[model samples]
Target: MRQPRPRPRLLPLTPRRLPLTAALAALGGLAGCISGDGGTPPDTAPPAVHLQQPAEGQELAQPALQVVGFIRDDRGVQRAEYSLNGGPPQPVALTPNPDGSRSFGFQAALAEGANRLRVVAYDAAGNAGAAERRVTYRPPPPLPAAVEIDPSAFAGGWWDRYGPTYDSNPALADHGVSHTHLYGNDAGYVEYAFTLDRPPGTALATLRARLSSNFPGWSGPADGESDVTVYLNGKEQGTRRVMADNGSGGEYRFALAPADFVAGRNVLRLEVKSGSAKKNGLAIYYRALLPGFVDTPISIAFSAQPLPSFTLEPLYAPGAAAFAIAQGADALYYFKINRQNGFDVPAQNFESTGFTGSILGTDLNRVKVTFRKDLSSGDRLAVVVQAGPQAPLGEHAFWAEGRGGGVGSSPAAVNLRVVACSSGCR
Candidate 1:
């Protein structure tokens, strides 16, 4: 190591020494400021706040309350507080949601009446902002009674109108009677006619009729087809086709104008045609515009035995059973069997039973049964196998009668059937 010329004696400046130099420079600046050499003061901005949900004077029906807002500046939000109806403030988390909106929700039991909600937001910089809204809270409304009817009372020429009975049977007793008759010849062609007692101020909207089975007893090879034409006040309204072989029996559902119904009476006429034997009957049901129109028919469903080919006897065991009287349309009949004779079934008077039923007028083929009570065991029921129409020129009287007694349930028994009349048989 040859002795290099003595390097100029130099001292290293340590990190501590550098800081000291900076401190001296700061002091010099202060001295200069005292000499009036300082720059202008810095500019400061305040944080901002806004509210999103529950506009002013809004109504809130739900339980959970969500308070949302936004704040400007990176001075991250610190805490959020909310109050309902001037109550004590509740602290809420300042968590940012994935939707870029900050929200705070609390399980608050607000006062019953009018309520005022206030939300206050604070940031890390101690900047605070607030918003408020007025809201009303109310309870829900009560429920309404359900729409219903009875099918058993639908039998006979007319259904007796009664009051709303909370009893298992909701239908009122026969207030008026609806007359329906089927008259046909061996040719399988039938005609049906009926008269309805239209109550004062009542508006009839729909007329419905259901058949127990398709046209029967016809020998023609062509599938029997039934035609239904509706006449309002003897004026033609509309007509529809009913097919029996396709499994669609007969149903005629048509809309009636208010003028079509008179304050005292309204008449309806139906015509039927079959390819073979005249084997079918109809059960009619009507609907009015007014609620609780006691005299109007609500539902009319019917049952029939296997006919034409299958001589299967009508199942009459007292119980709930479904029967397909027409294609795509089936009727339910509830039978109650008993040892005593409490039920009186005469040649007429089928409306006393408590069965809720319905009939569609489109083809008069389908019947629907809704029972309030079940039927007793071993009950015998007479169901119509087939029926058809006849000429209006004859004087025919058709009726049904029966008698029975037993330990009957609330609804008793419900049965549907088709009535047929040959020459001079109506």
Candidate 2:
């Protein structure tokens, strides 16, 4: 390679010096312009905020919310506050750090829909720094249609010594033990585990229980009373004091909230207190009832007025039979007509297969007829049965098969005795 053009002689570099006045000015600028008295400068900049919780655009299910974050400044942070949905400011809890920073925390109740959350922090110099976030809150979904936990579903449970004994058979000693009946002077509880399709909210549920007591068949001088406490999972639901004064073993109903139940498996507990009876304390046999799919007759009466459930009397009707039926929920019920003894349903009065106008069929006890709409909310319907001229006159029994909302209830027995009409029948 050609002589790299005589390399310029390398020389050692030397630092450049500035005037005394210029040096002092540069130092003052770095110090943020110290006061004339040589004191620290005021903090003009606001606090720097870093939100750590409820990130922006977050969606929440519950109204109760907890906010957390940190704030920093060159100077020490003084205080902090937060506001939700443009509401009044609320104080925040601050934790101090060695580096002139503060960690803040607070709680806020969010409204139903979109919520605006703003957190502001102040430094010793009264400078404020703010951070804002938008979050949306939604309410929980509704409860399922219905649920029913039978007696056999409950297995053995724990027994606590008295304050509330978790007993297995609280009513085993009543002498005629059937179902989960509880009676005695010792306080005890029984828990039933059940599964739900959805979370139990505030929807209405019922507890069908019989509260009655006697001194082993009329031995005690006075009727006894028992106190019972109901619980869903671990939460207290309600309490009741049932009296053993009714001889018929009257059923008492207790209203329950679905919210006490969870989606999957859940526990229902009944805590009974010791009573002051010679032999029995509080005799209670309870069953947990949830509104699901029910298809059964709540009540049936021959007259226009509604009657109590399971009410029956000797039936003697001529030509036609008229009655009323009541159900607990809305449904479409199918009535099955059956012959009693050797009676036969008139072949001319019903269809064999397809139900065209109201779905009527006849085949002795195998006949199915009467598709009627049943209203819920404790409503009843009137049903009239007219025997054809060719039909035999005797006793008959019928039942209703209810179906609605993709679910069904067991059929209920409704019996009737048809007498011959002197003037002939339809």
Candidate 3:
């Protein structure tokens, strides 16, 4: 049989503070109260105290609380002190009141939940009086818009899907005339709303909106694009002076922090503020506010083989140098891999899947790679990259990781670089 454990000894607890009324009541015998008919002897009664602000059991939205009131005695009030929720007492300044008595006032920062305020007043003879009040401080909740708009409301000839079709088609223009959706002098407005998530974590991984405009052959005005204002739940977020990437159509994007966004429903409004006749038309394409899958990454790699260590170079298309990696520019990186081991390659669904990698702290601009196995040196899956839709024009670096081969074979990761589209590109 197991031996019984001895009972744990309990420590003595500290004394709890008495309420102001109770504490002053216990001091009642030492000091006499004011006479019922105001006939008390001058030296017999103690000072009197009263609370003037924040009446008992009041609720407040602001944490900064003001305590004000009057203190009086026949021989004159000496000093006043106060405390909140049993904390240390702080001295309150006394000012002369118009009624021949003295008044006291001070401010205090209140903590959340119920707060107990205690005030003390004393006369020159050392007699004391006490009073108390209760208050509560709480902030209101954030408000989210309970509205939404259909995604199809943005479809038209001037606008297109976000994919390859979004690219500008000069052939669509008539006799070298620029094809653009016009908005000038008067504002063109559109509204949409969406419901995010609550509970504080990552509800939506990525929120994106892509758009662009068309510029006619004319030199137009100095500040090319029109003012595009974005509003979130009736408040201004930012304003973009949007124009095409040169005279041609170039995609422009705006992004928001996932964590800072409110939980639940939210509203988004876009307005094209008044513009001039010479420069107000835009070829609007691929505009959407979309939520994306962030953590849903499928295992991808070069091959399922006992990979031999080797180096690789940046693979790009012929027009890449002139155009760079542009917004909505789809790129395929060709890689020659030797999969001498087993099969670790997943089947490709090019149109449905997207691939991505990170360099330093920035996410690499890459879409999907639809390649398969060939057991030759650097001969299989090609790493596809897309230029940063929001990244600046410069040389960018990243790594491409391949499938991890089982049975004593390790996975492979290759370093790569892609030059972003330059601002000078049309």
lDDT of 3 at 50: 68
Candidate 1 regions exceeding 4 Å error are 1-47, 61-66, 97-112, 147-426
The Cα error of candidate 3 at residue 130, in Å, is 2.8
For candidate 1, report its TM-score: 0.30
TM-score of each: 0.30, 0.31, 0.36
Error of 3 at 176 (Å): 21
Off by over 4 Å in 2: 1-42, 145-426
Sort every candidate by TM-score, greatest first. Answer: 3, 2, 1
Count the clashes in each prediction.
Answer: 72, 11, 10
**Root-mean-square deviation of candidate 3:** 30.9
Model 3, stretches more than 4 Å misplaced?
A: 1-42, 97-99, 140-194, 198-267, 273-279, 282-426
Please give the TM-score that candidate 3 achieves against the real structure. Answer: 0.36
Please provide, for model 1 over 77-181, each residue's C-alpha lDDT reduced to its tens digit, 9 standing for 90 to 100. 677787888788888665453223354434455565688888777766666777787777653222112122332232222111221111121221232212221
Q: Write the per-residue lDDT of candidate 2 for residues 354-405, one digit (tens) a residue.
A: 2111111121222233323332222222234322112233334333333222
